[model samples]
Target: MENRNRFPHPLFYLFPLYAIGLYFLVLGVINAYVFLAPISIAALMTMILLPVVRKFENWKINRFLSTFLATCLALSLYLSMFVVISLQANSIYENWDTVSGRVQNTVQKVQESISGISGVSPDKQLEILNIPPSALSSDSTNAVNSQKSEKDSTSKKGETKESTAKQNSGVKAAITNFLDFVGYSLLTFIYIFFFLFYRTKIRLSIVRFFPENQRDKTNKILNGSLSIAKQYLVGRLILIFFLWIIYSVGMAVSGIDSPILISLIAAALSLIPYVGTVIGYVIAMMMAVVSGGETGQYIGVSITYGLAQFVETYILEPFVVGDKVDLNPLVTIIVVVLGGLVWGVVGMVISIPLFGMLKILADQVTVLKPLGYFLGQDDMGSKDDDFLGAIAKKLKRMFK
Candidate 1:
């Protein structure tokens, strides 16, 4: 009896155990994500640059030197992009006075145009709609006026100049943030270095998670995850590059000032998925407006963006991103939202590739096949209304 009890039925408790484990796993990840996000990012970066590291290793270069060189290359690219963006931002700040003046003028012109309509002037429209002017009781109006006067008196009394002190504080805060960012970046590179140096050992450790018989399958999954990360990263970079080129040419043709800077910044912003497209459009329009471009130039830029978006959606993305992820629209949106909620923009950017990796793992494991199918392109739940009907017919025939 004791021997028999040792091999309990799977249906009795296995499913509940599995569910409990999964719940805890997800909870842990969410709670610890701040510490984990950098690790995950470093891993993805390693996937992208692993080949370069390996190439140097193959050439008999020391592993530490190879990793350092690879990290330097990545850092230089990042710093160059940052500098370009910073320059554009600084230009916008310098031009704020002109831009603000133009914006006010544009608004005044819009108001004039609206008021020009004979029967539909704003005052007439409001009158026709029967919306009365906001009116305060005499006592309330007096109270408000007195309050405002008192505030102004207090402001005049306390209006000593401390702009220099404020500036110093702002500089100190910026320096502190820069230092923190540098420290985090240093940690990330160290993580990448260790990952490169211990790639084989890490693979072996991962393989040990499975039974001895399943090590091969585990290794294959690990490799597939790496491949997906590399492909996704490369595809995104190519897309960004193409966007930059298209935006640059269009802005130049439209005679916008700082066209290259505007284009590069707009193109990079386009990496944020659905939200990014709208942002890119707004940024381009703002750049055009601030540069005092003609209305025709604005229309031209819009047309250029529309065509580029069409080409990107219909041609470039489908080919380049391919079916690497294979997540359906519903799952994709949910994960994106969840990622955004958890990690902000970084979460949104990485969610798709992370989901792709999860899908691969789900597909590989037999117990998780149902999840794999759900993450896949199939609509298994709605395969047919006749599915039950077919089963009933088969049962009836067999019983008959």
Candidate 2:
């Protein structure tokens, strides 16, 4: 009995092994991400588009045709957005000169304002930043003349050939990257199609992996995970639509050019959580400045973003997204940051739903239920009973 007591728990003995396995698991995920990302994204996409496929089936459409139609519909929607954004981008390129001038003027005004407030002239600020005044100046008078005479006298032909070769290589690289993207997209759609077509088989196979006695529980957990992903994604799409509308109307009212383009970009960036929203605000502000917007216009953009965020956090999220994922705030932030570090923007976008699925699995498994509890929101308790609050209380007690 004394020896048994000394052993404590089985998990305590196995903790080192668990840590080693976890480290390898994370390393494997990072290394295999190139292959895994497409499948994971396809799985999520399948979950989102499953209902559409089901509806077609209900209308007596065959599974193959239904899957094809659903995939095409998704593809078309993505393509339409791509076309719109590309056209808007081309418009910006065409007017880049005017935009650049306005941006420079705005920057100058801002620097003057800062100089007034901080009692440091713009030149002094530039010197402190280690940037020469000529670098920021629109006129390249002295610098261009000095470089032109030297270039004309020495190695101009060789330099031109080298520059040309560099441009050619850059173009080739761009084309190759574009082709890779297209091929990956095609592969992802194929994965989605197969996943949809054989979804039932896949589900049964997953269930069969467990013992007969646990099969029912496994199936239940799998279904619950799929439900969480579906609801979260669908609700997020609804939220994005509303955000786009609000942002567009707000930017237009503020007299910003290409409001639709800016709003759509901002709405899309909302996928990355807290960081995305900040980026969207900065983008909108830059656009405002580039459009030669006055102080009132700047204030309008601020008010618009403020109101949009207020609506998103207070009204839309609570109602639309609800507690679908049901993750605690701390866990949400940590997982998002971890996901970003692991897989970049795509990882950040999918992290919440993926973690939500993991939480479901944890809740269903006896040994992991404690982990699920930690991951879940604490709606049942007051602030003091929550994790951080409890930690604060313990610290206070120890100090006292």
Candidate 3:
């Protein structure tokens, strides 16, 4: 037999390299945007609103008109809400003295209640808090002198510590915060323009990535991805509305002052994933605890939050959020944590959807298929239920 030369296919071999390189390139681009977070995020938001722009186009509106109208309307709504919340926050701060007093009394009461069964005296228990003596001795100093001394203490010591810490941290925080908000806003706006303008080209480009024979599959996946994104966003917004309703009802039922106002702020922030609502709860409880000297109400609020999350995860997610955007819980956790670490709150909120989109992309590419599988929602789990089930089925068939 004559010796024959056999060589590997170039594109076949290159496909793996292409996938790996493409992913890293994507990651690098994302990192640059993280560094330039605000504008980048703004661009992202604009992309998100591209569908809305298209909606206007269907009405025969000019792109510039639609873009300007949609963007301006969004900005106006946000600013108005921002002003209302800011005013309410300012009012709360103005009456902080009263709020502080009420909180202190409630804490003391809780401490006293806890301390009743303790071996230690209230004075000893005070260090740990939530356990203390029922009695608080009167100060030896006259009321006026005590008030003066307290003012000095609050000014010189209490504020100094917090202010110094914030000052040390504030420079980076302020820059990052400003950039985060403004940058994302601007980026999103720009992205919206480009996305809307090149929407057809983008769709065609995505389809062209596949071989002609598989274009149908690619088209299906692309449409599915976009549909899922829309579903996810709208569902999240719906969940936020539900969260606001739950929080507002709880606060109102508990008879907390400023329930409606605080609820409004909380509801607005609840749109942020995870940390946002927790921050809201802490603020809401603090307000309640301080304003009323009622520790029970604060505890109730915390309970309600826990219950709400439980319902959301088990009930709301399945029914309302839907199973279209399936992603591994582990991946979800990692993405959320890493995004928050790299870009803070905005990163955390969008990480899930972004990762979900990436998963869809990976599914379309063979070399990246392993990554898609890894990021999949299904797993064998620690117990290997699939293995056990297979064994049991085999055993039953054998016996029969």
Maximum-TM-score candidate: 2
Task: State the number of backbone clashes in model 3.
Answer: 15
Better of 1 and 3 by lDDT: 1
TM-score (C-alpha, index-matched) for candidate 2 = 0.88
Candidate order by lDDT, decreasing, is 2, 1, 3
Cα distance off (Å), candidate 3, residue 225: 3.3
Per-candidate Cα lDDT values, in order, are 0.78, 0.89, 0.70
What residue runs in model 1 are displaced by over 4 Å at the alpha carbon?
1-33, 117-154, 160-172, 379-400
lDDT of 3 by residue, 71-146 (tens): 7766776677777777877887898777666666776677677678666655777656554233232332344445
What is residue 298's positional error in candidate 2, in angstroms?
2.0
Residue 42 lDDT in candidate 3: 48
TM-scores, all candidates, are 0.75, 0.88, 0.67
RMSD of 3: 9.4
Residue 240, model 1: Cα distance from true site in angstroms: 1.1
lDDT of 2 by residue, 1-400 (tens): 7887675688887999999999999999999988999999999999999999999999999999999999999888878998999898999999988888888788789899999999899999989999878776658657765668654755777878999999999999999998998888888888999999999999888888899998879889998999999999999998999999999999999988789999998998887778889999999998899899598779989999999997787567766887899788889889889999999988999999999999999999999999999999866457765664465456547656
Question: The CA-based lDDT of model 2 is what?
Answer: 0.89
lDDT, model 1: 0.78
Per-residue lDDT, model 2, residue 236, is 90
Those runs of model 3 whose alpha carbons end farther than 4 Å from true positions after fitting are 1-35, 119-222, 261-284, 293-296, 299-303, 310-316, 379-400
